[model samples]
Every structure is written in C-alpha cells, then in structure tokens.
Target: MAPNSSAPHTPERPGTPVIPGFAHRRVEVAEGVALHAAVGGAGRPIVLLHGFPQTHLMWRHVAADLAADHTVICPDLRGYGASDKPAATGPAVYAKRTMAADVVALARALGHERFALAGHDRGALVAFRAGLDHPGAISHLACLDVLPTPDMWDVLHGRDAAVGFHLYLMAQPPGLPERLIAADADAFFGHFLDLWAEDPAAVPPAVRAAYLEACRNAVPSIVADYRASATVDADDDLADRAAGNRLRMPVTVLQQDWGAALGYDAAGLWRAWAPDLRHATVDCGHFMAEEAPGRVAAELRWLLAR
Candidate 1:
C-alpha cells in the first residue's frame, strides 16, 4: 500500500508536537501497518529510527540539527509510538526483517528509493537488518548503542547479561511478561530512562511523559517485538552469519563501551559483520542521542560522508 498521500503533513497528535519546523504524517508501509513519521528539511534523505521506550521525539535535537542540510525523517518503529501495533500473529511478524521492510517502504512512499538510515537501540536492530536485507535501498547505515542480535547473545554471560534483564524478561513466551509490565507500566518503562541515561534531565518532562504514555498503551506489541528478537531475529542473524553475509554499505556504530564493562571486544565483533565499519565508543549512557546530540550528529555526518 502507498502512504496515505492525502494525510495532512501535520502532527497527528495535537498534544505533543514534533520538533519545530517539522511536519508529521502517517505513512502506510504495509497492509494494516502504518508508521508515524516526522519529516523536515530537504536534501539527501536520512531516516532516523528511535529506540525503545521512546518515540521519534527522541530525535528532536539531532533531527533539527541535521534538517538544515538534509531531509531528516524520524519514524517511530512499528509497534512504537503512534504506529500501528498489530497483534502478533507469529514471532516472524515483529522480526527485524519485517520492521526493516516497514522502513524501506516508508522511505519509498516519501519518494526516496535510496536514503541514509540511522537507528538507536531497538531501531538500530531494524537498521542493521535493513543494511543486510535491503542494501540497495539504504545508501548508508549508522547504528547507535547496540550490537547485532547474534553478537548480543554471544556476549551476554554473567553480570553483563543481567544488565540486559529486560531482554530475557521480554523474551519469555509472552503472557507473563505482558502481565508483569502492564501491572506497573510506567515504573517498568521509566526504569530504563532513569538507569540508562547519563543525565536524567536530558529528557524533558513533557518528552518523558510522552514516552511513558506510548509504552503504557502498547504493552502487548512491545513485548512481542522483543520476543521476536530472541527467537526469529536471532535465527535470522545466525543464518546470515552461516551464509557469510555481511553488511554491504559503509556502516558506523556508536556504542557506550559495552566491551569495557562486559570484557569482550565489541569493535572486533562488529568488524566481522561489517567489513567497511567505523566503530567508536561514546561517553554517554544508552541514550546517546539525547545525552550527546552534537556528538551523535557529528558521527552521523561522518557516516553519510563515508
């Protein structure tokens, strides 16, 4: 299905507007799946995908800065924010392959056959899949604060694995995880915002509230998305590895030195998957885009230049 071209290019939700100078619209990427995207500027197109527990609003600062010289497109990934949260028919539904397809179709709907792609956290997983699956569609790729699913699983062993407890929690068969999170959604979701941020104040009150609300309302879909990561997503990554498939485009990764903490060579692991790779460790916490937008934007520019 083509994007709803008739959909007004304005913020779909009245209470929470997108970044200033940007317009919001819902683009139908697949049947029964439409993504809410905030678009601005005009040059080479760059799609920004937000991480977990946050909406496209997380890109407010970075998007605004990039908008000056590039068409900045920020979309809340499927099952996130205002996007359609279809009930999971199977684990494959929320696989990164499906999510990546949603992004490719979204860019094409906006008249961009090939564009730069960047994703933070969960969105980074989708961007990784896009680079591997749709290399011809994504001209460049940048992933913020995440490793590939296979690498991620390989590195988790002791205390380091516990740090990602949420991964194991959501990876469970689903019903219990959904129930537990639903019981106290705000606190559960807010824990990451508080724990993973270098500066909690980096996320404004209004923006934080928006994230909480989005997560609270989409508990089931969110859990299902994570569950897919453990099963189908992991399988896809392993299959690619077995086939000796690597990302074809120039890839840049910005992560918060998980290797230093977990005692693994994060860069080396990434190098195996991306032959043309630029991996750097950032000083900020998980939410690097929020804590260090300037640095994130600089890295993105470098990726695009490469």
Candidate 2:
C-alpha cells in the first residue's frame, strides 16, 4: 500500500511537567540499535512514536505533559535519533512490521505488557501495524495524519500519484535518495517540514533546528524506512489482506480529508480495517501533533477515557 501525499512531519508535546524529570538518554534495544527512550512519571504506560524528520524530541511537549499523570515512554524509532542504524539484509529490517517490533520490544523492556499508543506521520504507520499485529498489548490506538497501509497504497497508485513522489523515490535502491537528500538535507526534507505545517510560526526556532539536524544526519536510515515500505510493506499488506485481520481496539484517526480529492470517504475506508473507528478532519495540515498539541493531547485523553 502507498502512503498519502501529505507532507511528512514530529515534537514539543505540551505544558510544563509536575514531577520534574526527563534528562535525555539512550538504551541498547538490539545488538547495534541503541534506541533513544525518554521515560518519565509512573503509572500505566503510554508509548509515543514520532514522525519523520523528527524524533522522540517531537513528543517532548506531549510526553512531558502526559508524564505528570501516566508513565510516558517516548523512543526514537530504530535508526531515527541516537538510535543505532544497522546494515540491512533486506527490506524486512526497515519495514513497519520491524519498526512495530522495536516499539513492542521497547515497551516490554520498560515492563509494559499492555499499553496505549499514539503515533504521528511515519510514526502513525508504525503504530497502525503494531496495533494490528500485537492487539493484546495496544489497548487504545490513536493515529495522527495517516490512513491504514492498504488504503494508503491503493490511493497512491491511482490518480493522486503526483502527491506521493517520495514513495517512488524512496522505494528506489539505496544510495540515490540518500545521496541527493544528504546533499541539501535541510531544503530536501525541510520542504515537507515547512510545507505541511499549517502555522510555520508555531514551530519554534529550537524545535525547527533540532528536526533539520536529525533528518540531515539520518538520511540512510530514513530512506531505508520508506524503501522497506515500498518493498516489504507492500508484501506485508498483501499478506494481511489475504489473512483478513482487523484492528480489535477503539481507534481514533484525525487527519486532513484527502478523501475528497482522492475519491473515497476516508473514514469509510478505515472502517474496513478497524471495527471500532472514529474519524475526524483537523483544520491543520499534516503535522497535527506539533501544530495542535493541546487539541492532540485532548484527543488522546479522549481516547484514553474511552
């Protein structure tokens, strides 16, 4: 399945914290992959997944705010932040399925067998797969600015092709996008970071600098993530479709109504995979998590209470 044409986006979660925690740190999740996990507060767990061109730092505001009430575990997905980027044997390594596993493993390491999840942009894709595969662990699901794997792919392959050029380019053999992207890292990745944002002024200078620096440094891993989506992810969706499994948790998706332009009720499409679903159109652009942190936080609390 193809990703939506929406610009890729991540952090700066919410208000001040109560318990005074959160010193930047790292942990070795796998042989070489040192996942960056920010742990704060104590209670039932809420694991956050950050979007592209950013990292766990994207959840800084939201995670810190949430940490006051519940244990918040925000990790830089494998190959994203200070996380180790391993050499890939194939697409499976960078596939969302694998990324989902990283989240699952990270949660287990943090002593959470059951937890709630919320993801943004690329992080949402990883969270979607995690919910489907590990239904028992993810009790509540929230996705920001994305569709399910199959529906997204279906939309991308047809009339809205131009909107998702990154899918085709990133899907290419390694070295191409990495080389080109690494050249003008800021302008390349920053284009989406700047464009998809509804309020550019909302993104503070420090936050903006952190995002650009991370994307520029992790071009190969980032490209591998998209590449795996094109190859292994395509096969994964086809396999899941053949098996006919749907998410078995209450699901909330807030996104731009690309459905109007792409031709389909986006919420209706989501119902095919999520039995319990609620969909809404947000006024902001692709980076809903960053643009509307308070609204996003309210929605997460809404899902949590549900």
Candidate 3:
C-alpha cells in the first residue's frame, strides 16, 4: 500500500551522514508516508537513485560534482534508508511501478517537472521503469550495472540464475529468508556490501556498518520488493514486452561487461529498448558510482551532452 502524504516524517531507520552542499529533507508523497531526500546544486535537476544496501550516500562523490551544474536530488528509495516502510502492500506497490511512483512523486515534490536520472543497482531498475512508465516526465536517463527486470530473470533462468542467489532465496517462502536475514542483520547485509564491491575498502567502515544496519532494519520491506519481482513484476514486464513499448528518451547505460557470463548483448539489448541509446562497459564491479566516481561522472557528462 502507498503511504499517506499527510503523515509525519518520523525517523524510522538509520541514514548515512549528509555530505557537504547536500541538505536532507523529508517529503510526504502519500497520506502517511514521507520520503527522506537529499538535495544539492542548481539548474536542470539530475536525480540520483541508489542501489541496495547503500543509501543516497552512494552517490555522494558523483552528486558532489554534478551539483556544480545540475541540481542534484538523491532519495532513499522507499523502505531502504529513512523512507517510509509501511506494512508491505500487495505485490503491486512493491513493484517497480510503485517504486517509480515514489521517484516521480519525490521529484515533483522537489519542484522538478522534468529532470535527468541516474540510478545504481535497485535504483537503476526503478529508473528504467520510471523512464518507461513516465517517458514524458524524464529528459535523460543513466542506468548503472543492471538489466531490465524481466530480461534479468529471463536471462538468469536455470543454470545462469545461480549468480543472483539472493533473488532465488528472496523468492522462497517469505518468512524464512526474511527471518534469516533479519536474524543476523549485519552478517547477511554486509555480505553483499563486501562481495559486490569491486574495491571493498572504498566504503568506509562506519558507512559499511550503517548500510548493513539499514538493510537489516528494512529486510521485510526489501524482501517484499524482491518477492514482487517474481510475481507482479514478472507479469508487468511481460505486458510491456507484449505491448512493444520501448523507451523514447535518450538513455546511457554503464555495466560491468557481464556480457561474457550473462550472454546479454548489452548495447544491442538497450538499442532494442531505448530509441536513443549509448551503452558501454566499465573495468569495474557492480558498484560503479562508488568505485569510479570520476569516470562515472565523465560518462554522465557525455551522456547528458548527447
């Protein structure tokens, strides 16, 4: 279920420290739920959506530079950072549809009728869905280290699916994985923070600890999100494919070149989905924003220019 915009913004979960030039705000989109957002810079808003485990802080280095020329808005995706985590609604609200609504609403709340977008990991999924679902509202899009939700599952089926064991495990009977993850929050959440990071040391100790704690705190909502992917999300993508609607806006994609293992035609796949597409692989891990902020910023600049 969606939250009420009239509800107070209460502190629910821990958040990464707001860096310099960035000011954090809590905005109510629905009746009772408010999203925690960080804003900085000026002109032509460029919103940053973070991946799993990490909050908007993941875009700190990148957002800092973009802040100079672009109004940077970074939000803790619903249920992840300080955002509302109401009782998980039906599979639809947790669906990327709902998540994208949170982003669209967040931008509108911040006076952004149009903006550029960049998302990392789970945020990337949200960005893709938002770009598709609200094509007219977004001007430019950049996705880091992810494929479309349906393509992700379709390509990963059977033998290739083992890479994302979390998906399989999260898809299992809910209470089990949710409880297991919640039980040893630090260990469960920190495992990915350690593994997925190309440079584990890039994230400070305090930051890593904070991210693990947030993941631990939001396990139920997070699991609910992944569970939706197996149900409603799968169906949504099928409908989209059946409709043959591709992104009409300019898109820039950055990935780890998992093409070798995933057997995905990265550029070709994006070309099929986006009308104007620029796709490339980086010599980095899944966490491109954190590992290579300079290169990522450079690519983003190039993408925006195009």
Candidate 4:
C-alpha cells in the first residue's frame, strides 16, 4: 500500500517540526506496516530510533547536528507517532525481531543496505535485536538507556521492579492495560515524560504535548510492544544466549547508573553481549537524546569513528 496521506492528524502533534531541514515520508517496510521517517542531510547513513512516549521529534537536536556530515534518518517505530499501527495479533507481531526487520527494511528502502544505527528506550531494544540478528547490515550500534530483554527481566526483582511498574502493567494479558491507559492517556503517558527526565524542561512544552498525544493514540500498539518484551522477546534473547550469539559490531551503550538501583553490573551485562563495547553512564535521565543531545550526538560520532 502507498503511504496513507489521509491518516488523521493529531492537532497538537503535526509532525517533526522541531527538527528543521528534514523531509518527512512514510515508507512501507512490511506488508501492512509503514514507518514515518524524517530524512535529512547527506553522507554515510545513520538511522536514529526514538523511545516510548516520543516520536522521531525526540531526535530534533541530535539529528540536525549529525545531519551536517551524516545522513540522519529518524523514524517513528511501528505503532508510534504517524507510523502505521496494525492490530496486535500476538506477541510475535510486536516482538523485537519483527521491529528490527522493520528498521532493516526501512534503511534498505532508503538506499542504505548497511548503516550506523542508534536507538533509545524501546527503540534501543529493537536496535539490539538488529545488531544481533543482522550483523552484516549494521556497521555500528548505539543503545541508550536500555538492556536486552533477558537482562532487563533479570534485574527487575523487588523494589527495583517498582521503578518499571509500567512494564509489569503493560505486560499483562491485554484488555485491562489498554482500557486503563486509554481512560486518561495523557496523564498516564505524560507522567513518564516528567518522571523519567532529570530535567523536565529538556522536553519543551510543545514537544511534550506531541509525545503525550502520540502515546494516547498508540496505547494498544504500545502496550503490545511492551507485552512482547516480557514474553516472546525475552524468549528470543534467552535462545540467542543459549546459542552463544553475540553482536559482533562495534557497540556503544550510554545509560544512567541503573546498576546501582538494580544491584547488578549494567555495563558488565552489556559487555557479555557486545565484544567490541564501550559502556558508560551518563548524568542525564532516560531521555538522554532530548536531555543531552550534544553528548548523545558526540557518542554516536565516536561509535562511527570506531
């Protein structure tokens, strides 16, 4: 199917307007799904994936800066922002495997058979899968503020799990999670924008509104995406580990000191999966791309240089 130009537009979230000098287009990456991507600049391709509750607009600061020398492609993952949100068939439908394939297809469709890839939050999980499953296709991988599905599950036990209450809630068997979230979508989704950010002002009012609206519209798909992580996604990660599969590409992980909170070696866990790894803690919160784009962009450049 061609890009649906007639899709209903959220009044508050027009598009990625914060990032100047970029053209927005929806490219069909799968049989029924198409990703809404912002393409900008020209050079080596670098695809950036945004986290939850935010769209490609989260890459506004970093993408523009990287666009000077690198072709920055920021896409709203399936079920988020302006991208196609298909009904959740099962855990497999929203598995990171499926989402990772979308990224590969999106890049190839845009003439980048191989490219540098970076993702934040939920996007990071997809990128991790991309690096592991399609090593030949990703030259370098950068993940911000996330762990592999298995590692994530390993660390969440008691009080630490409280921090990720949303995860447990969304991982439930569907119906209730969607209904509860839809009841007060703005308040539910907007809470994360405020709670997860060290500096709440990092995400400006307009951008925050855009994120909230996007999440409100994408509640079911977003929940399905998370629910997959707890079930099918975790199983995939464990299977890969049992098979001794690791990401061979150069990898850089920028995260907060979640290790201290979770009582596990965050860097060590990532090091086990990525042989060529550079893991470090950032001072900012989970939304590092928006909270500290300069630092995030610098790290991405470093990953490319490696």
Candidate 5:
C-alpha cells in the first residue's frame, strides 16, 4: 500500500529544521511507506532513531559528531516527523516490532547488512525491539531515557504515574486522544519540549518551532503510536520476558535518575533485558542528545568499539 508518487509529499514541511552536513532522503522501508532520513559520513553505519515530540532533527548535534567517524543515519520514526503517517488500521501498524522492522529495512536499503543502533524515548523502545527481534542485524544497541514497555507500566503507581499521564490518555480507545491532542497540538506537544529540557537554550527557537509544527500536523498517527505501546507493545514485552528473551548485542543505556524519583532501579531494569549492559544516570533532562551531545557521542563511540 505505497503512496502514489503523484501525491505531493507533505511530511517534510516548509521551515522544518535540518542537520547541516546530512543529506535528506525519503527511503521506502515498506511497500507504501517511506521514512525521511538524514544521512551523512562513512565507515561503519550507526542508525540513530529520534524520540517522541521530535524528529531526526533532534539528533542534529549527535549525528554531526558521529558522522565524523561512522556513517550516521537519522530517521524520523514512521509515525512522527516527516515520515509517512499510515493509518493505524490495527495495533501492529504502530507496534514497536513493526517500527523496528522499518529501521532494519531502512538500513538494509542503505546497503548496510548490520549496524549499530541508538534511540531516545519512544525510539529507544523501537531500538529495543530491533535488538530482540532482529538480533542478527544489530551489532550494538543504546537506549536513552526509556524502559521496556511492561517495565514502565510496572514501575508506575499512584502519584508516580502522574508523570506518564499522557500514556494513559493515549492508551484509551482512539477518538478522544486524537481529538484532544489535535485541538491544541502546540500546547500539548510544546508542554513536553518545555518540561523535559534541562537547558531551555539547548533547543533553540527554530528547532523548538520545528518540533511543534511537526507534532501539530501529526496528532493522529502520533496518538496511534503511543496507543500501540500501551497495548500490543506491552504484550510483546511481557511475552519476551516470560520466555527469557534478551538482547544478544552489546548494549548501553543512558537515562536521567528516574530511579530516585520513581523508586525503581533503572539500570537494574535495563540489565534484565540487556545481559551485557552499561547503564548510567545522566544529569541532563530528557533531550540528552541535544542537551549533552558530546557526552552522548562519546558513549556511543564507546559502545561502537565494544
């Protein structure tokens, strides 16, 4: 169900931010859907996935730094950024498994059989699934600021769950979430951009405007993506945990100290899934790639060497 080439591409909106050295591409990962990726550099490939409320642009700093050595491919996840927003006909359409498949396909399409992978927030979930479901294709994995879907649900209770209110909102049956979010997409998406950054200046005015614009235009698909996480993605993670499935690749996890606030060991939780894991708590906010690109890039280089 690929889109008609005649249908003018609308995802990469006018005034959308761009990474200076990277070349943008609309690569078809599925029959009908093409992912918008910013690719640059050479040598070994390392695909970087952007998180929620942001696009490949979030990786601008890190991607530029990594591109100096490794080939860095930054794609806006399917339902976000400039990528196709296929209707979520079923949960699988937006499931992490499916998204992971898209990532593998995108890399293979770019001529890389296997690549190191890293993702932030929602993208981390996709990278996690890619590591588990496509173990042979991912050489190394790094997840920033997110836990496995089931572990996330398990760890939140009472007031602690307030931090994830949007998860519950989006988890509800369709209609309402999309309507509510679309009603004030800017405020809804901008809230996180404001709330999650440790250094507000890290996300400059132009980048912030770009993120808001992307989210404003993508309310439905974005909601579907989150909705799948609460249902199918959670089920997938639980099934894997029950079957003792673990990531076979070398793994690195960088997260804020949610453990202290939420009463769960973030590193311990990640270790259960990634046997060879290196988890560290960072001082920055949720947008670590933008907030501390140097540290993030150094950690990635270390992971690549392993």
Candidate 6:
C-alpha cells in the first residue's frame, strides 16, 4: 500500500536530536502499522536502518552527509523509536522477513521502486533478509557490525557465547523476557548503549536519553523483535541457506575485529551469502555510524558506485 497522508503525523519528541534538514514522516506499510522515518536529500535513494536500542537518530551524522547528493532515509524499524509497535500477534509480525518487506514497502510508498539499502545491528539482519527476499528491489546493500542470523547462532557456544547473553535473555518465550526488560528498561537497554560504542561521548547525553526513552516505552515490541530472531528469523535463514540463496547486488560489510574476538571468520560467513561482497574490519567500535560516520558514509558511497 502507498503512504497514507491520512495517517497521523508523528511529531519528534521535544529536544530530540535530528538529522539537520530531514523531515519526519509516518508512512503506513501494512494494515494498522506505520513506520516513523526521517527522510531528506534528493537523488538516488538509500535507506538506512538502525540497530538494537537505537533509532533513526543514530544516522544523524551519516544521513546529513549523504543528503548532500543522495536521498537518504533513516527509519525506526517497526518496533523501535516512534514507529507503531503493533503487538506481535504471531512470529512473522516481528520477524526480519516482515521488517524487510516493511522497508521495501516504505521505499515504494515514498515513490521509489528500487533503492540502495543499509542497516546496522538488528537493521543489518533486516537488510540481509531484504537482499535475499527482494533481490530486485534493493540496488545495493551495506551491513554494519553484525552477522547473519544462522551464522550468529552458529558462532556462539561455550564461554564465548556469554558476550551475547542478552540474546538468550530476550529470546525466551514472551512473558518473562518482556517482564524482565520492562522491570528496568533503562538499565536493560542502556547497557547496550553504553557497552557498544567505542567513544561513549559519540552518543552524548541527549541522544542517549532519547534512545532510552524510546526503548522504555516499547519494551514488549522490542522483545518480540528479538524473540522473532531466535525463532522465525533463524528458521527463515536456515531455509535460505539450504536453498543456497545469495545476495545478487554489490554488498559491503564493515565491522570491528569481531572475527578475532569471537573466534569466527566473519567475512567468510558473509561471502557465503553474498557473492559480490567487500568485507572490511574497521578500527572503531560497534556503533560505527556514530563513532565513525565519515568512514561509514565513504564506504556507502563506494557501495553506491558499484
């Protein structure tokens, strides 16, 4: 469905940091669901998806820079930020497959049938799925600081898996995860915001507060999003893997030396899924878009060139 002008406009929270000139919009991508996005720039379009515990604002620096030439879109994935968080009535609702379709629908609703796609953290999972499921719709793909779902599960075992303990925490069946997270939403979500960034000041106080606020209000949907990953999302990836589905477009992956720390070849895993791939290790932390926006933007420009 196309964007519904009738859909209520979602106002930015007061003092919420924004991409200088980007406009906020609420675009309905499915029945009773609309994604909140910050859209700006004006040329070939590229959509940027945010990761866990962060919103479109995470792309503020990169989006503004990209807007100089390319139309840049940064959206709160359905369950995050100000986006509508319909109850996860079933598994598919919060699955990356569904979120991937939401991205494609969002772009089309804004008048582009095909556009480049990039995602960070959880968003990267969605972009990965989008590239596999809607190969013709996504012109280029860039993933930051994450592994594919099945590979992510495969890599974690023994003491090494402790780094991702939250994955196990949130993946539990519904009630307990939601209750535990909501009990101290800030502490739960803020833990990642604090731990993931190499430069803590990169996120600053105001933006961090915004993220915490968003996560606090959307705990259930957030857990549902993660829960979907542990179940349906992994199932989807397994099916894709068995069928040998690969991303057909030019793909770029940027990450810190996770392979060294996690005891896996990150690039090799990405190469199995993306035949046309360029994988590099960055010197910064997980929040590379915030910590090193210039390099992230440059890499995206390179991907667009291909």
Q: What is candidate 3's lDDT per residue for 95-196, written digit by digit as tens?
A: 888888888888887788888888988899889889989988888999999888777886786777777999888887668988888888888778788888
Give the per-residue lDDT of model 2 (tens digit) for 1-306. 111111111122343221237654455555555566777877778998999877777776777678778888887888786566877777888889988887887787667889999999889989989998899999999998887766777787665787888777888898878888888999988888887888886667777777787777788889999888777877887788789988899998988878887887888887887888888888887877777777888888888888
TM-score of each: 0.97, 0.90, 0.93, 0.95, 0.96, 0.97
Poorly placed runs, candidate 4 (over 4 Å) = 2-16
- For candidate 1, the 10 contiguous residues with the lowest summed lDDT are 1-10
RMSD of 5: 2.4
Report the number of clashing residue pairs per model.
0, 7, 8, 0, 1, 0
Global lDDT of each candidate: 0.91, 0.78, 0.82, 0.89, 0.91, 0.91
Give candidate 5 misplaced runs (Cα > 4 Å): 1-11
* Sliding window of 10 residues with minimal summed lDDT for model 3: 3-12
Q: Considering only N, C-alpha and C atoms within 3 Å, which residue pairs clash in candidate 1?
A: none
lDDT of 1 by residue, 1-306 (tens): 445342545554577846999988788888878888999999999999999999999999999999999999998889989888999989877999999999999898888999999999999999999999999998999999998998898889887688999999999996999999999999999999999998998998989989999999999999999999899999999999999999999999999988888899999999999999999989988999999999999999989987
Could you tell me how far off, in angstroms, the CA of residue 281 lies in candidate 2 after the best superposition? 1.3
Instruction: List model 5 lDDT by residue over 1-306, tens digit each.
Output: 243222223334566678887887777888788888888999899999999899888999999999998999998899888888999999999999999999998898778989999999999999999999999999999999999999999998999899999999999998999999998999999999999999999999999998988899889899999999899999999999999999999999999999998999999999999989999888999999999999999999999998
Q: Any runs in candidate 6 off by more than 4 Å, and if so which?
A: 1-12
- Model 5 residue 301 CA deviation (Å) reads 0.5
